[model samples]
Target: MVQARIGERLGLAPATVSEGVKRLVTEGYVEIRGARDVELTEKGHLIAEALVRRHRLAERMLTDILGMAWHLCHEQAEDWEKVMTPEVEEAILAKLEGEPTCPHGNPIPGTSSGIPWSSLEPVAALDAGAGGVLTRLLEDVELDHDVLKFLEEHGLMPGSHLTVMDTAPDGTILLEVQRAGTNPARVALGRNLADNLWVLPAL
Candidate 1:
C-alpha cells in the first residue's frame, strides 16, 4: 500500500499518516518498497496475521453465538481483537470449531490454507440473467453499518443465490435474490454497492 492510499482509506491527514508510517518504519514493522509503496516485514506480517485472525474469529463468535447482526459484528470485533488474550482466542476458536470466514465472508487469516472462492466478480459486472452465489461483501461495504443492515435484511449475505434482473441507465443493478422461505424478490443496488458485492458464478 502507498502512504497516500493508507491515509485516504483511514481518513487520516497526510501529515498524520506520514508520521505514523515513519514510526512504523523505524520500529521495523513496515518497509518502504517502490517509490511510494509500503510492505509489511515478516515480523509485521505475523502480528497482522494474528490481529486479523482474532478479529475474524471474534466476528464469528459475535454473529453465530451472541446472535449479533452481521453488519454490526465488525465494529465490536475490532475491540475484541485488541483485548483478547491467547487463551481467550483459543477458547473462542474451540467454540467456533475453526470457522473459516467472517460474517461478511472474508477469510480469517491462519484458519485455512486455500482461498474460499475463485474467479469472483462484482455483482455490478454481471449481465442480465447471469447469476451466482454471493461470496463476499468487500471490506468497504462491510464498514457501512446501514448498508450492511440493508443487505442482511434483504438476504444478500454470502452463499445466497442472486441473479441480475436488469441495469438502470444510472448504473443501478436490479437483482433477484432467493431469500429463505420466500419467493425470489427484486432489489435494486446502486453502482457502488453492487461493485462491492462479489459473486462466484454458478456452474
Candidate 2:
C-alpha cells in the first residue's frame, strides 16, 4: 500500500510511517517500487505470517474462552498477542483442539486448515439465486468494528450459509442467511460490505 494509506490506517503521521518504512527497507524486510509502492520482501512475509498467526490465536481465545464478542476480538487480541510467549501460544493452540480458524474463519498461518482459498469468491460477485457458505472475512473487515457488528447482527458469521435472493440497481444485495438453530434471515448488504465477505460456492 501507499505510505499515506498505511499511515491513515495505522493512525500514524506521514513522517512516522516514512521512518518505519525506511527502517524496514534498511533491514531488508521490505522494498519500495514506483513512486511509493512498498511491498514486503520474503523475509518480511515470514515475520508477518508469524505475527498474523499469533494474532488469530489470540482472537480465538478471546471469543471462545473469554466470551468476548467476535466483533471486538480482533482489536482486543492485538494487546494480548504482545505478552504471549511461545509456551503460552502452544498451550492455547492445544486448547483450541484442532480448530484451524479464528472466530472470523481466518486460518492461522501454520495450521492444517483445509480451506480452498482459490475457490472462494466474494458474495458481491454472485448474482441472484447464487448460494454459498460464508467462509472467511478479509483482514480489513476486522479494522471496522461497526462493520463487524452489523455482520453479526445479520447472522453472517463463518460457517453460515448465504444465498443471494435479489439485487438492487444501486448495488445492494439481498441475501438469505441461514445458521444453525435459527430461522433463515433476509439481510440487505451493500456492495462494499459484501465484497469483503468471501464464500465457498456450492457444487
Identify the candidate with maximal TM-score: 2
How much is the lDDT of residue 9 in candidate 1?
Answer: 84
Summarize candidate 2's per-residue lDDT along 1-203 as a digit string, tens digits. 89999998999999999999999999999999999999999999998887888898899889878888888998999998777777878988888777569788888878877487899989999989998999999887889989889989889989899999999999999999999999999999999989999999988
Give a tens-digit lDDT track for model 1, residues 73-187: 9889999999878898778777875555788888877666224555788899999999998888888986677888899888999878999999999999999999668788888
As a whole number from 0 to 100, the lDDT of residue 133 in candidate 1 is 86
The residue pairs found clashing in candidate 1 are none
lDDT of each: 0.86, 0.90
- After superposition, the stretches of candidate 2 with alpha carbons farther than 4 Å from their true spots are none
Model 2: lDDT of residue 78: 92
Against the true structure, candidate 1 reaches a TM-score of 0.92
